[model samples]
Each structure stands twice: as structure tokens, then as C-alpha cells.
Target chain A: MTRRATWRRRISRMLLRCLPQLMPADKVDWATAMTREFDYIADDSAALAWTCGCVLTATKMRIIAMVASFTNTPHKNAITSVAVLVVTALAVTLMVVAPRTLTPAGGGMAEGGHVAFWLMYFWPVIMLISYAATTRRGHCLPSGFLLLSLICLYVMQIGTALAVGPAMDALFHAFGANVQAWDTTLKLALLVPPLLTVLQWLALNRLDRTLTVRSMRNDSFAA
Target chain B: MTRQRKASAQTVTVLVELANNSGQWLHGYAISTATGLKSGTLYPVLMRLKESGYLESRWEASPPAGRPPRHLYRITAAGLRYLAATDDDQVSTSAATR
Candidate 1:
């Protein structure tokens, strides 16, 4: 209702909107800090906690699917690995082409283009590193990776504002577009990457919780 | 002087270590480094014990010991009992092996 609250709501919505776009399509495994022997361990309680991915992401879902498949036939590990690769490839294609062909209007040093490029590039690398680490330890991907991504997002946004704000203002003035329009555009562009990163993390966390619940159910039944 | 190989201590050994050093206020960092464990691993174990009322911890007071008040931990009465049970189990296992 208040002006500040209204603005906050708009930003939140904007961020939530972009997160799904940045996320990998297939579920990531929430368990394991590094990739290693994911089979049963000696200590059920500790092993469960370690491998039970506490955060949900598409990566986690994919891991669950793989594990479930492994349960059916351990020999399916190779096939599961291939399936993961195929799914990842498809997701990458979808992300790249699914912007609905919105022609980015270049207003002298396009802010949106720069932000999108960096976010897309950086997010996947972080995800990959995290995936590698948590495989054996069976812990959720380190929170530090997520934190680092956020910091990069913040720095890029500031850089964009300082770089593009002035250029866009001049361009808008020279043309007929209003200064306010350029400001809003620049601000939204700057905000996109960080928002997307947060959304991706939230998705990952959701996957983690779901996996934990499923594991808990199975464990109780087994007991 | 020859450097001794660090003792390969297990979770039970670490618990025993805490029990062995009970009554003496131990700093968290010192315990972690001595045990060759990441803080992440050490903190969680410490937290579980404290929450279960098996361990008690406090911030160390300074002067003479002019260091930052560190988290100091000691085993509780319950913890001592737990340690004794573990000892009994070890003894039984050793006897069975013999």
C-alpha cells in the first residue's frame, strides 16, 4: 500500500520472473558435497543427512530420478548419466532460445545485454563446481557458492548502472524517449541478474526439501 | 626430533577425547585444529552435543589469558555416562577379539 512497499513488490516480482529462466531445466542432486559412491553407508543417520539433498533445484530432482533408477537396477548408472547429459543439453537450448525473440533495443551500451550475458555465464559455473563437491559428502551444495554468485551479481549491477545510466540518459534525451523511461529500463536491467540468481537458489532449495521429505518417508518405511 | 604421525581418530575417539579432557575449558578453534577437522564438521557435532545437554560451553574470560573470548566446551554428567558406556563397549569388543 505504501510507496516503498509497492516498489519492493515490483522488484520482487521482477526477480522471481527471471529466476526460472536462469535455472538448469533438469533437477540437480541436492545431496553430496562432492560426487562419489552414492550407495548406502555404514551409519544410516549420518549417511542419510549427508546424502539427503536439503535444497531443491532441477539438479536435485535429476539426482533423485537417477538414484531411484539406480535402486531398480544398479547397472543403469551409465544410462542415467547419459540421460542427465541429454536433459542438460535440452535445458541449455531452451534457455537460450526461449526469450520469445524480444529484440533488445540498444540504447547506447545496452545494460540488459551485458547483465544477461554475465549472469548466464557465471551461474552455471557455480552450479557445476557445487555439483562436483557435494557428490560424496552427500551434503547440500555449499552456501558459499550461492553467496559468491550474489556478490558477483551485485558488482555487475553497480558497474552497469555507472556505465549505462549516463549513456542511456544521453541517448533518451537526443531521441524522443523520456528520461524516466530510460531510468526505469536501466534500473530493471541492472536488477535482473541478482534476481535470477536468488530465484535459482530458491528453486534449488525447494528441490532439496522435497528430496529430504521423500528420503525421510522411504527411511521410515524401511525401518 | 621426529614428528609423530597424527593419531587417526574416529568419531568415537573424538567423543572420547572430549570426555578425556572434561572439566578443562577447551577452545573451539584449538579443539578443531588439534583434531584436524573442518569447522563445519566440528561445529555441528558440538551443537548436537550441547543441544542434547551432553556438553556445556561458555565464552572464555580474558586477562592473563588475553585472548578473544572463545567458545569453551566440557562434557556434562550425562556425557560422562555416555563416555563410560562407550568405554564398556570398547572393552567388551577387545575382550571378544582376544
Candidate 2:
């Protein structure tokens, strides 16, 4: 019913709809790797999407698998879905609270803005490493390491928020301002890279599809 | 009649079994054995059904007696509806065939 829930459902639906052609499980066995590799090298757009879908699906599966193991229930799908919805809600709340502030200017990168910046930059890497280390991929204990790192990071954020709340207001006053313009600027800077990356990916996919269609047409003409 | 026979004759009898056994958390191994499908074939079908939102699976922890883990699969609400519709169609076709 919340805006966040509505958007999450929308995005999930879009992702699922786009998934069938690109899902990695289309191949029945490991031996299909060679063909998959060749398809990738040939720069097929469909194959690229399939690769992306597979990796995304695998990462999601890993999250569910880990949750299931913890609960000792192979049927933790419903629970995992709830967790994802909660995470999405948290992300929306953070965005609303932060409200597009510019990254604060130089407390030698120890300011509240700097802390937020690092949190955004570093969390995905930790999530991915943990994902790779677990499930059928190999190297198990690294899963523990990944979870530890995440916990440590969350604890540090809590500590910083408590320690810096007063200091941030004081610093804003010292800069002769009542508003936090730096946080807004920093947010814009942080957001641009990912947005650009997504746009570039989509454009590339379109181009690849056009080229594939052209190639197929030429082949038919030659035949 | 012809269509009922075709549907009835389909491998694994998913309709009858599901119609009879709906709502139970069935084991993957049980389904495989009943259907006479190899693990490979059954697993992919299960995975596909899960992806399509027709079924669900959960891992049950090993019992305190220290057995290995097992996954239990169940038909979702959507799957139940699909099975019911298929059963209806089969009944109509069977009557026509008769």
C-alpha cells in the first residue's frame, strides 16, 4: 500500500518479465558453458541480458538459500520475500531522510556526508563478495567473513550517527549556513555514475539487437 | 474424447496427482519417483514452475537425529487453479470421447 511497496512490486514485475530470454538456467548442463562463452564473444545482446539475468537470479537465490539454511526450512521463500520488502522500505526511508544533500565539504572526509558516501560505495562490494563465496560457487567460510564485515559496517554507522549528530549542526553553523548544501551536492555526484551506467547498458543492448537482426537478414538474403 | 485421452495419457499424470494431492508439501524425490523422471528432468521442471509462480519450495532443516537436509515443494495458489482448470477440460473431453 505504501509508495515504496508499490514501486518494489513494479520493478520486480519488470525484472521478471524481462527474465525469460536471459535466464542462465536455459542451459541444461555445465557443458553448455562452451556454447555460452562463444555466444558472449559474438556480442549477442540477448546473451548479455541472459548473463545479467542469471547472475542477478543467482545472487537472489543465494540470499534465499542462506536464509533458508539459517531457519532450517527449505521453504523460506515467503520469509525471504518479506526481507526484500523490508530492505526496499529501508532504502526508501534513507532517501527521504537524506533528501539529496550535497556531499559536505572537507572534514578531511570524516564528516557525516563523507560517512554516508563511503557507506553507499562500499556496501555493494561486501554484498557481492559474500554472495560469490556461498552456495554452490565454492569457498564457504568467506560467507562468515562477509556477514561479519556487514555487521561491523552497520555498527560503525550507528556509532557515527550518535557521535556526529551534534557536531554536524555545529559545523553547518560554522560554515555560515543553516542548510546542508554539501549533502545535496554529494548525493547528486554519487547518483550520477550508476544512472549513467544503466543508461549505457540499455543503449548497448538496443544496438546489439539491431545488429543481430541485420546480420540475420543478410544471411537470409545470401541463402 | 481424443483430447481427454491425450491429456490423460500425458507423462507423469500431473493433473490427477496434483488434483488429489493439492495443498500438501510434497517431497521432490517423491514426485520424481512417482513420475518415473530422472532427477535432472524433474529438477528443471520444478525450477521452471517456481520461476513461473506456480509452485514454491522450502528447505527443511535436518532433523535433530542428524539427517541431511531436504527440500519440500508445494503447488502455489496459481498452480492449484491451473490444475483445476485442466481437470475440468479433461472431464469434458472424456465425456465427448465416450
Give the Cα error of residue B48 in candidate 1, in Å.
Answer: 2.2
| Candidate 2 C-alpha lDDT tens digits along A64-154 | 5445445763334434433433343344224223322333444243345555555556655644453344322222222344334444544
For B4-91, candidate 1 gives per-residue lDDT tens digits of 2322233344456577687887765456545665443554466556766778876556613433334567888987876565555663
Considering only chain B, what TM-score does candidate 1 achieve? 0.68
lDDT of 1 by residue, A20-115 (tens): 332223221111211121122233333333222222222344465546645664454435433433333333332232221122455333434344
* Model 2 complex DockQ against the native: 0.03
Off by over 4 Å in 2: A1-81, A84-110, A136-153, A160-163, A167-223, B1-92, B95-98
- TM values, all candidates: 0.30, 0.29
Q: Is the docking of candidate 1 incorrect, acceptable, medium or high quality?
A: incorrect
Q: Output DockQ, candidate 1.
A: 0.03
Task: State the number of backbone clashes in model 1.
Answer: 31
